[model samples]
Structure formats: structure tokens, C-alpha cells
Target chain A: MTQLQGAAPLGATVVAEHGPTDPRDQRPVRGRKKVGIGKVIAWIVMVIILVITIFPFYWMLRTALSSNGALYGNSTSLLPADFSWGGFERVFGLQTVDEAIAQGGSGAKLDFWRYLLNSVVVATCVTVFQVFFSAMAAYAFSRLRWRGRNAVFGLFLLSLMVPVIFTLLPNFLLVRQLGLIDTLLGIMLPSLFMAPFAIFFLRQFFLNVPHEVEEAALVDGASKVRVFFSLIVPMSAAPIATISILTYITSWNDYFWPLMVSYTDDSRVLTVALGAFRAQSPQGGPDWAGLMAATLIAALPMIVLFALFAKRIVNSIGFTGLK
Target chain B: MAITSPGVAHSAPNGRTSVDARRRRPDDTKLALLFILPAVIGLVVFYFWPLARGIWLSFTSWDLLSPSQLIGFANYQRMFADPVFWNAVQVTLWYVVLNIGIQTIVALVIAVLMQRLTQSTFVRSLILAPFLVSNVVAALVFFWILDFQLGIGNQMLEWIGLDRIGFFTSEEWAIPTIALVNVWRHMGYTALLIFAGLQAIPANLYEAARVDGASETRMFTGITLPLLRPILGLVLIISVIGSFQVFDTVSVTTGGGPVNASRVLQVYIYENAFAQFDFGYASALSVAMLAILVVVTFFQYRITRAGQTDLN
Candidate 1:
């Protein structure tokens, strides 16, 4: 899985003692030229794959910016057709119903802003409390010594194996029984306290914390809780931030559970709302431009977060994927 | 957050001995309980309880309006005979095969290329951009881009002297198309995982191989593949598990449409529980899915030896 083919040409050059002046070095130079061709081919392949991966996002933006009316006529155009903000205006309910219909939108009141607000509220609540509580539990597992701690941690690990779908139905029922259906609290409740991954991730980091520091604090009469809150939490801020970004993204993008529980606009999130928007198209067909605009908006927060924490998020993928 | 040196009043006379004994036998049971209570409560209530209740509910007949009646293995029997469930199983397996097969190969290639070519964070971030988008967003973007009437994908096909393919509308193409859409979203993240694995393989192994004039292919197969087994096993298991539960994209794009061609098991379960209110049947189906996953995971672990490492 690694390529050291370039080393062959280098080895050839190293073996040629007289460098470029020697006839033997000419052969190595030709070999080096061949390696250059291989490098060019590899670079070409990388660029193609990069384009495939990134083009759809650019396409989303282009389509979002295009006029809905001219989309079909200019289907093959790489540039936006009839350059218009009508799609976004319709999505944000900034256009009159007549103007929306003229632009090929369904003109249905989407409550896009409300869904955005709901997503923010739900994601924030889940991320903050989940990370905080999971960190506390991780502290217990990693720092404090107690009987059956491994057993409990093992139980949490096992929970990771349980598919989310298996518990999804019952969780919905539980939330409904609590009369939190169609409320932001219901969307946030199941995830608010702790997640198995969060605890597991934090515990992994906490295990690496030096015991000497905590011991020093204990000798100074600092309570275990104080050490955790003051010393451990501060030191573990990087991992905490990583898990927080992850939890926030997951919470924000969750669709099925929210779809099950939230019926009205009052509790609907951007993901579910976008689905509803697509299905709510008029007889003329879906407002493609408007839908793309809404998708872009729904995806904006994540894209922004990714931009800000791209390195952190990309680096965390290796750690999270292994789990 | 500075821990100020406490006065003598705070540090007791026995602090030194207690610290030493604590080192010998630390028992913070009471504090541990306090720290762990919230998570324990969450686990028991949200995860463990619902799991048990879901299993129990699987054996009963209920439709939300009436009290559930214990029906023993009847729900399981119905599931066995249900054609839709069977179709869903077949569809899901096909999807898993396609999704995991294509995704793993592509990701491994990309990971290898990245390892060989450049360690550019910019390139990795660009590849991972699609994954950062929510499934709904990815689905909708693809929906519009692949739209049969005006989608640029079809237009390009036409420009290339081919017929326009109904990506989401046709029965044969829906599952494959959906799988590809998801592949686009997850391949980068998967590649990065394998790349991390690649990074862990000691460079000295490659150096020694080069010294012996081992070809790149030989080095990769002999050295890299063996050392990378644990991570490959892990990536496969994670992706397979995730692939089996393909919901968000399907839900947003096709809603398991075109004669239920894209109706994977999760969609089937969601429809049964929410649309039809057949909670018992849904629960039974979920239990079946869980059992299959457990078996699959066990076999994968055995075959891959993911728990073991070839490296010393």
C-alpha cells in the first residue's frame, strides 16, 4: 500500500559514482525521466478523483444560484442559468406566492428559518450535555478506581455494537410516552445525557493523562471532583472539542428519529424539513432550484464548521472510524 | 484554573500516608458513583432499557391504539413469510455488496495514492467535503443533478451519444445509484482511515524491502497488506454495519420508490412502524436484522483477526 517506485530511479543515480558526466549516469537519467512520466500519471489520477469528489458541491451551489425557470432549457450549462437569487428568496419565503410560482416554486410556506433554529437548538443541547456528561463518566472510568469499572466500561462498549435502528422504535415510544413528541426536547432527550461513543472516546484520552498529576493534586487535598473539573477537563479540551464538533454534526444531520417524532413545523429540523419540501412539489414538478437552495442552507452550518475545524475533523475520522 | 498551594489547614496530617496508600489501593467508589451516575442512567434508560423493551415488544401484537397481546413467535413467523421483508433483505444485501465493495476498493486505492503522492491536507479536506454535508443535502443535490428531465448527468450522457438513464426512477438503477451517492459521501472518510493505517506501518520495513530491490507491488502485498489487516478489518466492519442501515439518502431521494427497488431493510422497518403502525412486526424485523449483524460481525472478526496485529 505504499509506493516506493520512485526509489528505483534514485537508487540508480546513487549507484552511478561519476554523476551526470559518466555514460552510466545517462542510463539512470533516462530511468529518472520514466519515473517522471509515472508521477505525471499518478498526479492526473489524483486530480480526476479530487474533481469527482468535489464537483457535486460546486454543482449544488451553481444550481442553487440558477433561475428555476431557465433550468430545463439550459440543462447542460456549466454556469448558472439566468443568474437569479429567486431560488433562495423562495426558500427563505422572501418572495410573494405569485413570484415564487412564476419562478417554478411550490410557494408553500416552508418555515425554513424555524427548522434552522430547531436544528441549532437540538444540536447544541445534545452536544454540550452529551460531551459534558460523557466526560464526567470517562473521568470516573479513567481516573477513579472502583470495583466493576471495567465491567461497566465493557457494557458501554457492547452498546456500541447495538445498531441504532434496533432501539429507534422503542426510543420513539418512550419519548411519546413522556409527551415530548413534536417538541425540541424530544429530539434532544435521548442524546442529551450521554452517548456510548462519547464516553469511549473521552475514556481513551483520559487513560493517557499522567497519574502523577492527579496524585499530586490529591496530596494537596484537592478532591477527586475538583481535580477532574480543574485539571483533567482543562487538559482534555482538544479531545472534548473534537467530540463536540462530531456530536453536533451528528445531531444536526439526524433524520429518522426526528422524522418519527416531529410532525409539525414546531419541532422539525432542517433534514426532515428538506425531505418534506422535496415531497411538497407542485404539479409542474419539484422546485429544483428552490430545493437545492434549501439543501445548501441546511448544509451551510456543517460546511462552515468543517471549514473552521477541517483539520480537527479530518484527523478525528481515523480515531472514530477505528472504533 | 490554577490550583493554588493550599494552606496547611487543608492538607491533613495523614495526607502523605493516605496518598501512598491510595497509590497502593485506590478506591474512590463513592466519587466514582457520582461521576458515573448520569451516563449510567442514560445507558440504562435510553440504550439498555429500550433494547430490552424492543425485544419484548417484538413478541407481542400491538398497533399503538390497543394494549399489546403476547403473541409468542407469530410475529417472527409472519416476518419469515413476508415477501416485502424478503425483498428488503435481498435489496439490502445487494446494496451492502455494492456499497461496501465499491467503497472499500476505491477508498483503499485513494488511501494508497495519498500515501504515495502527497500528504496534503488540502486534498484530503476537498475529498472529505462531501461527507461533511448532511445525507439530505447530498441526496437532494444528487437528485437535482441526476434528474432525468433536466439533470446535467443525463445531458452529459446525451452529449456523449448515449441515452438518458433514469437514475432514481428506474427499478434496476435506483439501488446502485443510491449506493454510489453514498459512496461519494463516505469514500474520503474511509480512505483517511486506511491512510492512518498506512501511516502506522513502519517506514523501515519499506526501506529494507527497497534495499533488497523488492518491487512496489511486492512490497505492498507482502509488507503493507499484512500489517494493515487490523485496520482493513476494522474499516470493513464499520462500513458494512453502516451500509446495512442505509436510510437517510434513500429516504430523501427515492423514499424507497420505483416499485420498492430501493427499499432496504431500514426503510422497510420505518414504514412498518411509523406508516402502518405495525410496531410488533417492525420490532421483530429489527431483531432479525440485529441477529444477522451480530453473526456477520463475529465472522468478520474471526476471518480478519482484527483483534490481533502482525507487527511486533
Candidate 2:
């Protein structure tokens, strides 16, 4: 137990599973701590890399804040010289490019708010349905005894290798044939059910739950359905949440399918909108400040979600790998 | 994903299944099917059926408007003969090669450094920040930052009195630029994987090597790298698979580029299917992609299986 305590301080379940277990894991030398050149070098390297990783977002924010004149000005200032909210206003439709230009401001005419709402709706539905359906299937694969179970599971594993592109064109045809084209439902229905990777990841997590716990519930006259809802769901919240976040991110970031199906602003998501918005700019190129503002607004939810769940997201990736 | 026997066999300990448990097996099977029905229906409709139909679509001349005509192997022949297809294949392979090389080295180095730190959530989160952003956003950010005219990248070059390079407008520089953005977006996830592998290595091995007066570089080469083989293999396979399907980045930024320099396989397939309304040809291209992936995945599984050790 002490060894487990010393294994990892936070996000320990994933690390604990992968952590060295044998006594040979312990070092002969211990209990010495001081600053060293190696430590300094590591910090320096980390700091430098961190800056590089973060600078792009900082630049996005900085550009989003600048006025159009300031952005295309002769001098490229290191700071936001002409900071304003006009770009974001154009994005939200509180102001339009014509209105801004008429008043000597720069803006773009985009259905940013509509796209944001569509992204949220699609991502949320995909997350909820994908998690529920995956959990149901994972439960069967991990705990229940059944005929042809291994065969069906094998099909799932095999399909994992089939690059989504192959299914994509045919599936698009399927959706179009069903007369579901140009609708958000067409964009959402294909992937909203369950994914092979989600099922596999969840199944691995479910397999780790000991048999005794479920047996105990069964002995108390609990049906399999009862046991699943009463015991499995409660015990597997961590992994379920992890799967939910992953699904939401993937669905929100999804561009190709949405781009294929959605043509009008009524159904277009942020990613597709961003692309259309870019192409709609005047001859000189996109309005850099307004474009940056739209980009930030599109990315803000994910960045915030990532910030909040950084540890779990990392651990989920580790857990998926270890399996 | 392999269905091992342990979970089932372990439940009945001592090789003894009571008569009651044996009798209950049928009920378990029934309940299992019930629980699995929703997903199974989805898989048949969306996954397996589409895969089989995609193959059939590949043989037919199904443009979006007209009915499909049965013309077996014609799509393949046309694809093989087409210069654009060949260019796409060349572009995709080169992108995969360069992407894997850059991502593996950068990720491994970052992982090694991260493993040395005691408390690294903040730093790790910063590294992971880009990974969370949608690829479109990442491309857009890079699109502006690497803009030939007002780009910070070129601005910095001007500050240093160096020639401003054409990032997306030039044939030679475009693909590599896109590949670099791909690396920047994904390196953190791979680093975390390798970092996890590092943590699982027993410390006594390092201590023993130190007792023998081994240099740090020797210890790294002799122990760390070898122990990291499995995780590194996983990273390599994943990077290769992902790089091959490069679409969003290319579409949003280059749109297959300044002279089709970055016309990756996915973008190429997409254009054929949607833009040109050549569903059969698009399906053929997708099949080609699947074949390449299958071969690559087979070799990866074989190599990893052969070099298998008790990773944990």
C-alpha cells in the first residue's frame, strides 16, 4: 500500500496500473534533494517548450484584440495596440461587416452564433448517445456470458482498422438515399450510435471490475439490468466520463462529414463555418482580426474543457494505451 | 481487444462451476444479447454494411446524379493510370514518413524530460493545450501565424534580416509546413504515452547501472530505449495511420495547395467523391487506402508480437 502511495501523487489509477510493482523497483540511493545543473536544464527545456506550445494561442488572442488598421499596419507591434471587441461583435451578429465599415471599423458577416449552437447540439448528442450505447455493449462483452460473443467482438476489432474514409462515402450515400441530406441529423446519425474504439476502451475498463461485486448484487435477487444500472454505472463513472469527453471533442472537431452534408448556415457547425468564413473574405484575403476572433470563439469551449480535465484526459489516454 | 479466457475462467475458481451457475448461463446470454442489441444494430447499419457496400461501390460507375453501372476493375485501372492519383500517393507516403520521423523524435525527447520532473501537471497541460484544440482551429492559428505577408514567422525573419519564406504558396515548402503543424498538434499525446512507459520501468535497474559507474547516455541506450520498444512501436503505428488520413489540415489551410503540392490521400478522395461527383473512383481510392493500412498494421502487429516482453 505504501508502494502505491509512493507510485503517483495524482491521476494515480493509470500510473498505478503501469507503475513498477516488484521490490526491485526501489532504488538503492534515496532521500537526497538539492538543486542541480540537470534540474536547471530540465526546467529551462520545459519552460521553452511550454512557451512554444502556448505562443500560437497567445498570438490568436492578440490578433483578435487588434483593430484592422493596426493589424495590417507597417509596424507589427508585440502588443495589442488597437484592442477592441468589434471582431467578436461581428462574430456574434451584434455588428455586421457593412455596419462596421460604414462606421470605419472592420467586421465579417458570418453566422457564428448559429454555428456555435449547431456544434454544441451535435457534440452533446453524440457524447450522450455514444457513451450510453458503448457502455451497454461493453457491459455485454466484459461481463455477460453469451454465444458468438467472441465472434461479434472480433468484428468490432477488425472494423477498427477500416479507416473511416471507406465507410464515409458509402455512409454519405446511405444518408442521401434516406433523404436525410443537408440536415444536422444526417451529420449526427452516422456516428452517434457507438464507435469501435469507444466500445473497446470501455470494455477494457469494465473487465477490471471484479466478478464478486456483480455476483453479490445478483445474489441479492438483482436482475442483470438492475446490477448494471445500480452497480456497474456507479463503479465506472470515471471511465464513462472519460469516454464522454473524448466523444464530445472528436465530434465537435469533426469537419469532413459536416462539410459534406451541411451547406447552409442553418445546419453548419463551427469547423465548416470557419472554412466557409475564410473563403468568403474580400480580395486581399480574410479579415485577419475578425477571423481570429471567430477562431478563438470556436476553440474556447474545448480549451476550457481541456483545462478543467487535463489530468483525466491524460490518464484516459494512458489507460487506453496500457490496455 | 483479444477476448482472453481469464475473465470467464477466473470467475469459476478451482475449475468448479456449480450446477446453479451452469443453469444460469442461458439467462446471462439472453440478457447479454438484450444489452448489446442497440450497438449491434448501429454497427450493422453504419459500419459493416457500409464497408461491404463501399467495395461494391468501388466497382460501379456511380456518379452522384446517375445510377451506378457495373464496371469491375475499371475504377482501379483508371486510378492506377491517373497522374493525380500517383501524385497523391507520393504526397501521402512522403507526408507519412516525415510526420512519423518528426513526431517520434520530438515526442520521445519531451517524454524523457517530462518523466524527470516530479510534479508536471501544469507543464503537461501546456504541452497538451494544442492537442485539445480542433485541427481546424490549429490550422487557422498556423494559417495566420505562418501567413507569408503578415505572419509572425516571417515578421521575425524580417526582424533578423532573413528572407521571408513562402509557407503555403510554394511547392517545396507547403507539405513540410503542414507536417510541422501536424506534429505540433499531436506531439503531446504521444509524449504522454512514452512518459507512461518510462514511469513503469523499475528504478533499481538504473541504480544498478549507476553502481557500475555507467554514464547517463549509456544507461539511456542500454536500458531506457530498449524498455521503451513496445510503447514506441505503438506510437509509430498510430502516427503512420493518422498521417495517412491527413485531411482537415490540408483542406482548411492548403486546399491541396499551391500546385497540388499537399493533395493528401483523404483530400484527394474527398474531392473525387464530392467535388467531381465520382463516387466509384472515390470508393476505389478509399479501398487503396484500406489496403495500405491493413498491410502496415499487419507488419506492426507482427513486429510487436515478435519483440513481445512483459511490458509492465
| Candidate 1 residue-wise lDDT, B216-303, digit = tens | 7888899878878877887888888898989999998899989989999999999999889999999999999999898888898889
lDDT by residue for model 2 (B1-312), tens = 232212123343624544545567788887888888888888999989999999999999987787789998999999999999999999998888888899889899899887766435677777878888888999989999989998888999888999998998899888899999989999887887777767756676666677888877887887788766765776567667777888998998889988889998899999998889999999999999999888987898688652343333
Per-candidate iRMSD: 12.8, 6.3
Error of 2 at B246 (Å): 0.3
Record all residue pairs in model 2 with backbone atoms less than 3 Å apart, i.e. clashing: none
A39-126: candidate 1 lDDT, tens digit per residue: 7887898899998998888888898899987887887678988899988898888999988988899878866898999999999999
Where in model 2 is the C-alpha error above 4 Å? A1-36, A101-108, A321-323, B1-22, B302-307, B310-312
**Tens-digit lDDT track of model 2 for A1-323:** 12222322222222335311232342323233667787799779877877889999998999888776667773267787488887777777787567766433345556688999999999999889888988999999987888999999988777776777788888898899999887889999988778888887778667777777877677677888887898988898887888888889989999988999887987899999988877766555567777899899989999989988887776655545422
